[model samples]
Target: MKDSNQEEQRPKTTFSAPVVLPALLGLGALLAFCALYPEQAGRIFPSVQAWVVRQFDWFYTVAVSIFLVFLLLLAVSRFGQIRLGPEDAVPDFTFLSWTAMLFAAGMGIGLMYFGVAEPLQHFLKPPTALGGTPAAAKEALQVTFFHWGFHAWSVYGTMGLVLAYFGFRYNLPLTMRSGLYPILRGRINGPIGHGVDAFALVGTIAGIATTLGYGALQLAAGLHLLTGWNTSTAAFRLGIIVVVVGLAGVSAVSGLDKGVRRLSELNLSLALLLLGFVVITGPTVFLLQALAENVGGYLSSLVDLSLRTFAYEPPREQGWFAGWTILYWAWWISWSPFVGMFIARISRGRTIREFIIGVLLVPTAFNLLWMTAFGNGAIWMDSHVANGALAQTASNVDALLFRFFEYLPATRAASWLAVVLIAIFFVTSADSGAFVVDAIGSRGHPRSPVWQRLFWAMVLGLTAMVLLLSGGLKALQALTLVAALPVTLILLMLCYGLWRGLLADQAHSTQDLAPATSFWSGQHWRRRLEQIVHDSTREDVFRFMQATVLPAMHQVSDELRRRGVLADVQHDLDEGATVRLTIPDPELRDFIYGVRIAHRHLPVFTVQDASEDGRAQVFEPTTFFEDGRQGYDIQYLRMEEVIADILRQYERYRSLSANLRTHLLSRAPGHSEPMS
Candidate 1:
């Protein structure tokens, strides 16, 4: 009886209904909606997708703005004294695992498809403003790296840094709430939190929607390339779905440590082997020269390439930019949140600076190498091969990969290897994506029940099936960027929140100082505080409260002297009777209250009293009593009431200015600070 009673008292560890019910219902609704109104649903999906595309472009603007802000803060912190967190202690995975996972997760299927096609497309219709002749093969390699290099990695790296900081340092949950925790910590349980979470959820759904659509297209393309099958039929879609779901189900069951990691390793090895084959068998001199010259060109053009907006400026080159550069950017931006969160989870214990450099620079370098090796081989063949056989037959990218093998000595064996590599690559991408979706749904922890992951994996596969059934691979490709659009706004919000969090952290560290220290002798503390304030705002009292308070005392003394009053007013003022004024700033009051609230729910600091002039003041004892009671109380409750009332009014105003409010609320700590 006692055992039964104890068991009843124990907390239930079952999955929450909030997490489960919505997912199940969402899946059912999607399936049913598609079934009930197939044509309408298809059109609606794309129509909604158009909104997503616009959002994606908006996100690019936001990302660029945030990136600049981040760099500025970094510069300020260098000059001022600001530190956000203690040194990270997470172990860095060795190069093999890191590269394998990074390559598989970051590029995967996209790389395989675009390796040959992108360069060729550029060769055929080069950007007109760049003054390259049509079929000018020299620019092929340069264009390839331009497309695959730093900008794509920059988006991924930025997202990853946010995820790592929140997950490892803050002891927060792994959902969208945790991702935005730097900005929305206490508000996570509120409507604001719910909206953020929903946005993240939608982003995940959208990414999967795009991926599923593309995966179906690629599967059909691969079949058509290798087996000469007319894969444009409805049956092809069902077959692809079955294969994807079966593979994903197996991988989902195997879990990340075994299935995903092993698959990544295999994919990486296959990719390396393909590169080696090209380097050895293809025109070696031409390939190496192209790589060296293109790399140099890419390095020189990096800044321009990174900032190119492709805004339909030159009417002649508009199609080229829109079809290639803009589309790719949108695709990458859409994938950023998921990829970033996953990278962040894996990147704990690294510094913010290190995380950014590694995620942006290193992976981009690798991508450049990958593209140069594969893209150069195709360019070489197109330029110098016997009869333009490679270019003519290579109608699609998948054919290009295998056709390179046809030039090899062991054609059949090489073709088999290519097939195996393709399968592994798809599995790696699909599984990694599944894990990411699970993480987003579970909110970043590894503790989400296995069934939840499996359910999502199935849903993703089904989405792919629907896309394939509607049209062939071309149809899927057309819709990929469209689905990724809405999530772009979510990413912008994330960036804002991340920046704000970093700034806040810097401020907190700077302002916290012992009371006994003099400003000159406390230069280290002063510098740190100054750095924090400079990083976000000079008026950031949160960063330099102690320093600011000390200076304010001097200002008061100088004002009194100017008024022909005695200089020793500090000694005459009644410390016990001085009142601490409270104002109508919820954020400010929250900060003040936060300082007072203890782990045990008791107030650590309190209002001491009000002055004769009706101003309120708060104080702490210079010396400790036996009971160590701080000399304060809630003497200004009426002031708090008034502040609360004003806060409500401010919220109304905020609602009217939603975009501004979002920008303000989204600013992460190091990005923005409230005025003292």
Candidate 2:
């Protein structure tokens, strides 16, 4: 971890080479281009945005395709060798901490904005593909879940796993190389590595810049919705920028563990409280029933919905899949690399399988719940009261939550709560984004200098202000996707690397060595042997030697011990005829010598009494143990070293094994160097 205090001691204004000039140049060029070609830019911006989204869609398709291909190759690669490292010593956070941080970091301002707006939009204009009437209550919650569920979460989870495995598991530096390290481990540290890192950095900044831009626009919209002021005014835009920058700066200065985590926890609690209020005061029965039914619908339709392209022929409103669904998916995928890297940083010590399941499943569940409760409420109102309030309010996404509150019994109270909720949501989302961008820009370390974090935060706020001034939310959204393109490509590469790494791990863990029956094989081994040496020993020593070394020697040794040599050894030792003697092949003799040296240097283990029932137990050498393995006082340093060595050896042998070599050679001809 980088030292926060050390960072603070440095001159705050000193900018790193990577950030200063490029940022200025990029910002200047963007402003100039937009100014010089205002009309042309405006006309082409949507098409450009659409093209970017399409490219993301294409990138995702390619990623999924490559992932599938890798899966096929993995199936034929060999069995059971590749596996994630040990899961011992992983962090165990309190449920409250876990839930709060995850909820806050995972969702963001988008949830608050979409919570009411998205569901209501779908209810008023239920996708034509569903063959349902507008405002049909049944389709309302379903559509909401479609947009917020597993598909969106999958993008986040996949990217996070790639970063986590490569960053933590491999001990690689935090950069795009780390993200792509599983695939390009040893291949990194070259021009190729620098190129990968540069690409990642550009994509990350662009994506984060775009997100901040959206956040700023949404913040402006929220302010307008609450204050009834025109945020379109230059003063309001500047004011929004100032407020965002100030908030981010304060949080950045406070440091991540204290400021960011504290804010996230508070935001999460407030969101839950708001949800609770909705559940209590709103149509409770309706919300629960809708949630249950929609959850079922989401599960059953998940596979088809995830893959739906929403290709409606130029007639109806392109269905839910294209207009809202695909757009959200593309947006999530674009944001994945940035968000994923952040998640990976926070998720050190977690298993790849665990991280994936949590990232994909937990967030999806929360999204479903939010959509069901809030979205179903809108659907119920439209159906029962015959009010067009939700439909009317949804014309502007900014006012959706406000309108939802207006229809409630305690309108003023609900409005106030909604305002608070929106503010916290906005702050939490901004903080999360700032944290993620800091991680990316810092090359994966969370302990970024306070000033560095503040810099990014300010840049985000400023960029967002520019976008808002230029057009508004649409412009911000357009820019975000545009920036996300390169990041999307990097993520695709990450996916390939993750698949390869996992398969390689699996292959190494399941290697099998058996005796050869052919004379050719025996001769092949004999040619490499230099000599054999014999030693006489007591029955106990002979038994220990045979039990400890024979099986391993069978895999590497050439010749059997000679009876005459053993007799001569026994005679030299002056042992009785009944005493046993053994002679190791020269290679085996070297192996034994190495083992003895290792044993001699082995650290001493001091056992402390930890028996709960007052019974002392002998050390069990055959069983695996780590520190705290037997009530936290065994001091298993030696054990840990031994296990680590075995794991390293297994990895080495698996890479060199003929089966894996053949498999890799078959898959990619010139790229078959074993992953380090």
Candidate 3:
């Protein structure tokens, strides 16, 4: 068996240069064009943004609404029981750690930027309620919640779920193309696959660039507030980008565990500290009331908010749909690749249900709370405390959070804390973005060259600076919105691919893998029971896997090969022993039965001798398979029983493989690869 070091040091195969090179060149060329001719870009950006919004606004609304419904259906369906990886796999991070990382995804930056600004903006120009009054306050919360709520998460959840399922369950590379494997199969390794991956990478870069732009501006705002610095200059904001991006480069080099994870935890703690202070210093009871009211209003109007297009409204009100609501949808869609794949990477062992619930609900609840506390604090200060100072400078959205803190006690300290939070969140965002972009450019290997990661970090910093100079908020919003348009169809196709892949996998795993009882029954059970009740030991388990379990698997492999199927047994001391049967398919789930020995700790109560039971550890020979079912303990089973188990699994695999080969429906020419 190869040691852990060998696996860790294993060189990855070649990345698709065709995919990586072209994507970077195209995106970089456009960014360069914008940088060189800001005048032309300024004119073209609005026109393109307005046209796409006018034409595809309905598509965004319907696509997002469908994604929410799709998630609900999938979560409750039979597929919910499916594991992201093999059934024996366990979650990499604890629930708390996972939830913290989810929150620290720099969404706090958005909340910090918009939590107050958006609500106040909506309240000033009443979307539905009376302007600057009680009804408008409630309406403001509802609108803001809609922007940050389920729709946004649904976009993210769909992408993450699809990527995780395909990557883990199928042993495919963890890239966006893997999500299309149901339709594309091996074609996912071809040019078309490269195109898909390239498109996702480009969108991710643009989204991160936009995030860096906003984060830098907010950081600058806090600095100006605390120190009375001249951050009104664009050079200062550009400097902030350079410093954060360099810090991000260092973190990216340190990798996810050492850098990103630690930083995310820190950011979460700081964010909670700030949130707690806001809740206490501000009107705590009123914030609570607003939270409840905000959620209620959102729930009641969700259907309308979901489906509303402002169709038939005047051109004036309709513009809000194109700008605020539609803009948010595009940003979330663009964000899906970076955030979705990042979430999927950390979520290897979770079930489909757990993943969907965590992705769709946990961060969203945090967002609503964060927004209510912060946004409502701003509104309350405007009406009853600070005398409309926020609205007077609403156009400078970046400074609103700093100005709001000024109304509270210890203004400078609060502003400085907010600045640090944004800066760390900025670094974490860039670190993760570079990591994800590396994965895309390297065909799902995040451990690409250190120079490659730093390269992308530089690109992000430069992109942010150039775009900020070219058009500021208009450029950021415009690029993200335009970038998301072409990618939307890809996201939709991924959903369909996920749907088909699930059905295909369900058929595969459900094939009749019933055990044969003749040889392993009666006398065999007695011998198995004798072994089962004994005090467990490592030597005993290893001996069982080698002498009994492996031989039984070999027997099955021989019989399968004799029957014309591809079957072989491979064993190693560290990698364990396994018999893998491969049954190929053209367009659907491939048939595979890889049964191997895995270890689990003995239950403390199951230990026989008190001395050894309390102290000495025992290992069990547990079986695992490709279908990701909870494997059985086979250490005590006879050779005949092991053979029966292998046969049973193969029966299920072949049954599904045959059906998928014969029955998978084809899509239109452009929708899927040519039907095999």
Q: List candidate 1 stretches off by more than 4 Å.
A: 1-88, 129-135, 216-237, 310-313, 393-395, 472-486, 508-676
User: What is candidate 2's TM-score against the reference?
Assistant: 0.68
What is the overall TM-score of model 3 with all chains considered together? 0.75
Report lDDT per candidate.
0.58, 0.56, 0.81
Residue pair clashes in candidate 3: 511-652, 513-648
TM-scores for all candidates: the values are 0.69, 0.68, 0.75
Q: Candidate 2, residues 1-676: lDDT per residue as tens digits?
A: 3676676665544333463455456655665555456556566666787775554554554454443343334335542222233445464444455556666766766787778877777666666535225335567677677666666666666676666676665666555566566555566766666555554444455555555555555556655666787876767756756776687678767765677678877877777777888887789987887778888887788666555555544435443444565566557766665666667656666555555556666777878878877877776775566466567557787666766766677766766776666556556556666666656555555345566777777766666556556653354355556655565666677767776776666665555431112112344344224211222123433343334333333322222233232211111112321211233322111111112101112222333333234433222112111111221111122223333433343343334344654444223334445565
Clash count per candidate = 32, 10, 2
- Tens-digit lDDT track of model 1 for 1-676: 9967865664433333455456556655655666566676667665655554444543554464455445435434541222113453644566567667787888877777777777766666677524224245556667678667766776676567656666665666656666666556687756665555555554555465556566555666666656788987777757766776679778878877788778888888888887787778877887778778878988898666666655646755655655566677777766776777667655655566656556666667777777777776776666666356766755665466666666666766666666676667666666777777777665555556567667777767776665455442333343445644545555666677776776666666567444232222444565546543432222232223233332343454466468774332122122232212111223221111111211112222224432234433223212211122342221122222323423343354445334444445433334545444
- Candidate 2 stretches with Cα past 4 Å from truth are 1-24, 52-88, 92-95, 129-136, 190-199, 202-232, 310-320, 445-447, 482-486, 504-676
What's the lDDT for candidate 2? 0.56
Report the Cα lDDT for candidate 1: 0.58
lDDT tens readout by residue for model 3, 13-101? 44569777888898888787777877777788878888998999999999999999999888999999999999899998889878877
Ranking by lDDT: 3, 1, 2
